[model samples]
Target chain A: MDSVTALGLVAAVLTTGSFLPQAIKTWKTKSTKDVSIVMYLLLCTGIILWTAYGFLIGSIPVIAANVVSFIFTFAILALKIKYK
Target chain B: MDSVTALGLVAAVLTTGSFLPQAIKTWKTKSTKDVSIVMYLLLCTGIILWTAYGFLIGSIPVIAANVVSFIFTFAILALKIKYK
Candidate 1:
C-alpha cells in the first residue's frame, strides 16, 4: 500500500489497540468506580457511527479500526454496567 | 457539505466529545486507582498518530476529531499521572 494508507493503518492499529488495556484492567480488577460509564456509552454509539461513516467513505482503515474499537468499547461498557 | 461527510462529522463529534466526561470525572474525583494508566498512554500516543494520519489524508473530520480527542485524552492522562 501507499505510505499514507500505511500511516493510516498504523494509526488505526494504535488507536484501536489502545482500548485493550482498559478492557483488560477493568476485567481483572472488576472495578468501574473511576471509569466513566457515560464516556463508554457515548464511545460505543460514536464507534458504530464511525463504522457506518467508514463504510460510506470506503475507507478500509477507518472501518477496520472502528469495528475492533466497538468490540473493545462494548466490552468495557458491559463491564461498567455490570460492575456499576 | 455532502451527506457522507456530514455523517463523518457527526461521528467525529460523538467520538471526540465522549472523552470530556472522563476527563471531567478524573478531574473531579482525583482518583486514578480504577483508571488504567497504560491505556491513556497508549491512547495519547495513538491520537497523535491519528492526527498525523488525518493530516496526511486531508480529512477535516479526522483531523478535527483527533485534535479534540488528543486534548481530552491528554488531560486525562495528565490527571492519571498526577493522581497516581
Candidate 2:
C-alpha cells in the first residue's frame, strides 16, 4: 500500500486501539463515573457522520476507521448512560 | 462552504473538541495514572502522520482536525510522561 494509505491505516489502528483498554476497563470495573458522557455522545455523533461522509466519498480509510471507532465508542457511550 | 467542507468542519470541531476536557483534567490534576501512555504515544504518532497525509492530499478537513488533535493529544502525552 501507499504511504498515505499506510498512514491512514496506522491512524485508524492506534486511535481505535487506544480505546480498547478503556472499554475493557469500563467493562471490568463497571464504572463510568470518571468518563465524560457528553464527550462520548458528541464523539459518537461525529464518528457516525464521518462514517457517512467517508461512504459518500468512497474512502476506505475513513470508512474503516470510523466503523471500528463507531462500534467501540458507541459501546462506551451506551455504558456511560447505563452505568452513570 | 460546501456540504463536504461543512461536514468536515463539523467532524473536526466535535471530534477535536472532545479532547479538551481530558486535556484539562490531566492539566489540572497533574495525573496520568488512568491514562494509557503507550496508547497516547502511538496515537500521537498516528495523528502526526495523518497531519502529513492531509497536507499531502490538500485536504483541509484532515489537516485541521489532526492539527488540533495532535496538539491536544501531545500535551496529554507530555503530561503522561512527566507524571507517569
Complex DockQ per candidate: 0.84, 0.50
What C-alpha lDDT do the candidate models reach, one value each? 0.90, 0.78
Model 2, C-alpha of A54: deviation from truth (Å): 1.1
lDDT of 2 by residue, A6-25 (tens): 76777778887777776776
lDDT of 1 by residue, A1-84 (tens): 899877777777888999999999999999999999999999999899989988988987778889999999999999999998
Candidate number achieving the greatest DockQ relative to the actual structure: 1
lDDT of 2 by residue, B1-84 (tens): 779767867876888888777788778888665465665777788788888888888988778888999888898889888887
Q: TM-scores for chain A, candidates in order? A: 0.94, 0.92
lDDT of 2 at A5: 73
Q: State the local distance difference test value for candidate 2.
A: 0.78
TM-score of chain A of 2: 0.92
Q: Report residue A81 deviation for candidate 2 (angstroms).
A: 3.2
RMSD of every prediction: 1.0, 2.2
Per-candidate TM-score against the hidden true structure: 0.96, 0.84
* Lowest summed lDDT window (length 10), candidate 1 chain A: A5-14
- Chain A agreement with the truth for model 1, given as TM-score: 0.94
